[model samples]
Target chain A: MSFINYASREINLKIVYYGPGLCGKTTNLQYIYQRTAPEAKGKMISLATETERTLFFDFLPLSLGEIKGFKTRFHLYTVPGQVFYDASRKLILKGVDGVVFVADSQADRLDANVESLENLRDNLEEYGYQLEKLPYVIQYNKRDLPNVTPVEELSRLLNPGKVPEFSACAPKGEGVFDTLKAVAKLMLISLKKNEK
Target chain B: MLGSQSSLVLFDEEFSNITSILEKLLVEANAKALFLVDKDGQLISSTGETDQMDTTSLASLTAGNIAATGGLAKLLGEKEFSVLFHEGEKDNLHLSLVASRVILVVIFDQRSSLGLVRLRVRKWNEELEKIFNSLEKKAKEKGAGNQSFFAEITDEDIDNLFR
Candidate 1:
């Protein structure tokens, strides 16, 4: 849920990066952390296993400067994408304002991407939210890798809803900011439309 | 207001009441710090010795911790695990759910005991719940009457942030 602190003149929104395991959810966050200016970002916290897979979540707090005298603070989180981490994933979805589904753009991982997207929809339903109504976007990640699925195919499968989508090689930072900006803009627009 | 897209608005009067309660809890419990964070991990307000602390991370992690434990509660057929305590070599954490909407986090150490902290919290939780309940009710009653502060923002204002 978005938090509006009138006393502090701050607006806080939660956005979750979600997809199947190794789809570059954490990598997306790491890249954002690396590129963000020191004053604009807070410490990124990753609750990961010893092997570096996300165990619970990865959190990065960012200041998106000020909009109309209110400091717009966005807390970016990544859910553990492993199959058995479904419960943890559901927990992270609570009060989320937007979502980024980072799909691995490889031929073989198509099933994982589909399953994860289905899982995302189901989990969202449990929270009384429909993915269709939420501020959501998809990132076709790992576009630089050989054997990557065609962007058209990825879009045909994932973007049936036709939300803003991007193709990115997260480690190289391609489309990273573009993806972030798209979803953040969608969120602001949604807030405008929903607010009284 | 409990919907996913809904917002929790903290106006000045409610904010002052919350901060005063936090400050009172700080001295009454002799705690190092007190943080009133929404279940979503947004830090509503904090008091006491937090200058050296990374409260942003703390708030996020604490909410995550509570969430994980809450998941555990479901498996065992419970409503929720409303209270959690973590003991460290020096400082101990006392986290409890307040009004099911916010988390009350108490960071204490050798200067305080769990029994005392819990006692004070039990009393204050009632007061906190009243404030939050009224806040939620007010938000609902205000409904469409509340205007969007961002109504004046334009596309240029958004695009400029990226530039």
Candidate 2:
């Protein structure tokens, strides 16, 4: 959820990146953290297992810029994509303003993508949020891999609602900013719509 | 709009009110620092000894800790875990849930005792709850009306930020 603090002249928005295990949700956050200017980004925190799998979630805070006299800060989080971490994922989605479903584009992970998307919808529904109505986007990650599905096929399967979808290789930062900017733009537009 | 939207809109008046309460709590509790963080990990307000600290990271981690503990509680057939504490070599942390929407975190050292911090927190929790209740009502009314700041914000204003 977006928090507009008029006292501090700042607006805070929460955005969560979610996908199946090893779908590169954490990689997407690390790419953003590595590229963001030191002054613009806060320390990134990862609650992960000993083997580096996300045990809980990952957090990154980015200060974009000022908008209408209020500093705009985006708090980016990534839920643990492992299926057993359903409870943790639901906690992370409690107050989300936007979501980016980072689908692993590998042909073999199609079922994983579908299952994770369903889990995302169910978790959001528990919080009274409709995935169809929220400011959401999709990223087809691992696109540089050989076994990846075509963008068209991925879209046909994952982007049924036709939210802004991007092709990304998160580790190398390909299409990272584009995906971020698109969802951030949609969130800002949604804010304006909410005021109406 | 505020009634349905999960977003939190803090106007100047309520913000000051919350800040003052925090400041008072810090002095009364004799703590090193205190922070008010929402359940979603957003830092709402904080005071004392925070300049040298990374409050953003602290707030996010604190919320994560609370969520994890709350999950543990549900498995044990409890509704929620309202308080959490961490003792360290040099400092201690006292965390409590306020209004079921935000977390109140107090950090203290050898100079303060847990008894004092708990006493002050218990007394101020009610006042904080009242202010937040009023804040919700005010935000709902203003959001339903037309005085919203976003009302004056054109798409250009929003686009300009990214540029």
Candidate 3:
């Protein structure tokens, strides 16, 4: 949910990064956290298990400068990508303003990507949010790997809505900001339309 | 998710009232700080000595903790846990649900006992509930008017953000 506090002159939006396990969701967040200026970001918190897999989520609060006198803040969160963590994933999607589907582009993970996308749809439906109506984007991540699927094939399979999609190698930070910017822009535009 | 999209629209008047109520809770509970967070982890209002604490991360973690507890409660045939407490060597945290949508988190130190914090929180909960109930009602009644405030914002206003 996008909380617009006119009293505080602040506009806060929640964006979630969701994908299958080891799909570079955490890597995307780490890269953004590292690149963001000190004044523009807050402490990144990750609740992970002993093996460093995201157990609950990873949270990063960012300031995207100001828009029309309102301080625009984006709270970025990444869900535990492991399939058994469906309960945790549903909880994190409660008040999401937008979602960045970080689809693993490795040729072998096609089925996992499709399953995760279906899961996203089911979860959003539970919250009364339609993927078609919500601000959504897709990132075909792990593009640097040799066993990657072609962008065209990935788009045909995962980008059914044809939302703003990006090719990213998150560990190297490629397309990280591009993906963020695209989703953030879509979210703001959606917020504006909702006001009417 | 609540019935409608759970976005908090805080006007100055309501915000002031909420802060005053929070201030009263801080004094009555003898706590170091108090934070009002949405169930979805947005920090709505904060009071007291929070200079050293990172309330943003705290809010998100606290919400996640509460959500996990709520899930456990369901498995045990309960509606919700409603309250959670974490006691540390020096600082302790008391978290309670308010109006089913917002959470009240109190961080206190050795100076305050659990009994006092609980007592104060019990008394204040009713008052906070009443306040939020009315706020929700007002939001629904004047939702169109409230939304009008944002109607003036243009695409350029949002697009220029990247620049």
Best of the candidates, TM-score: 1
Candidate 1 regions off by >4 Å?
B1-5
In candidate 3, list every pair of residues with a backbone clash.
A1-A95
Please write out the lDDT profile of model 1 over residues A1-196, one tens digit for every residue.
Answer: 8998889999999999999999999999999999999999999999999999999999999998988888999999999999999999999999999999999999999999999999999999898999999999999999999999999999999889999899999999999999999999888888877874
Compare candidates 2 and 3 on TM-score and give the better one.
3
Reference contact recovery of candidate 1? 0.72
Worst 10 residues of 1 chain B by lDDT: B1-10
Badly placed stretches (over 4 Å) of model 3 are none
Q: Residues A1-196, candidate 2, lDDT per residue (tens digit)?
A: 7888878898898999999999999999999999999999999999999999999999999999887788999999999999998999989987899999999999999999999999999998887889999999999999999988999999999888899999999999998888998888889888878888
What count of clashes does model 3 give? 1
CA RMSD for every model?
1.3, 1.8, 1.2
RMSD of 1: 1.3
Clashing pairs for model 2 are A1-A95, A1-A96
| iRMSD value for model 1 | 2.1
lDDT per residue (tens digit) for residues A73-135 in model 3: 999999999999999998888899999999999999999999999999999999899998999
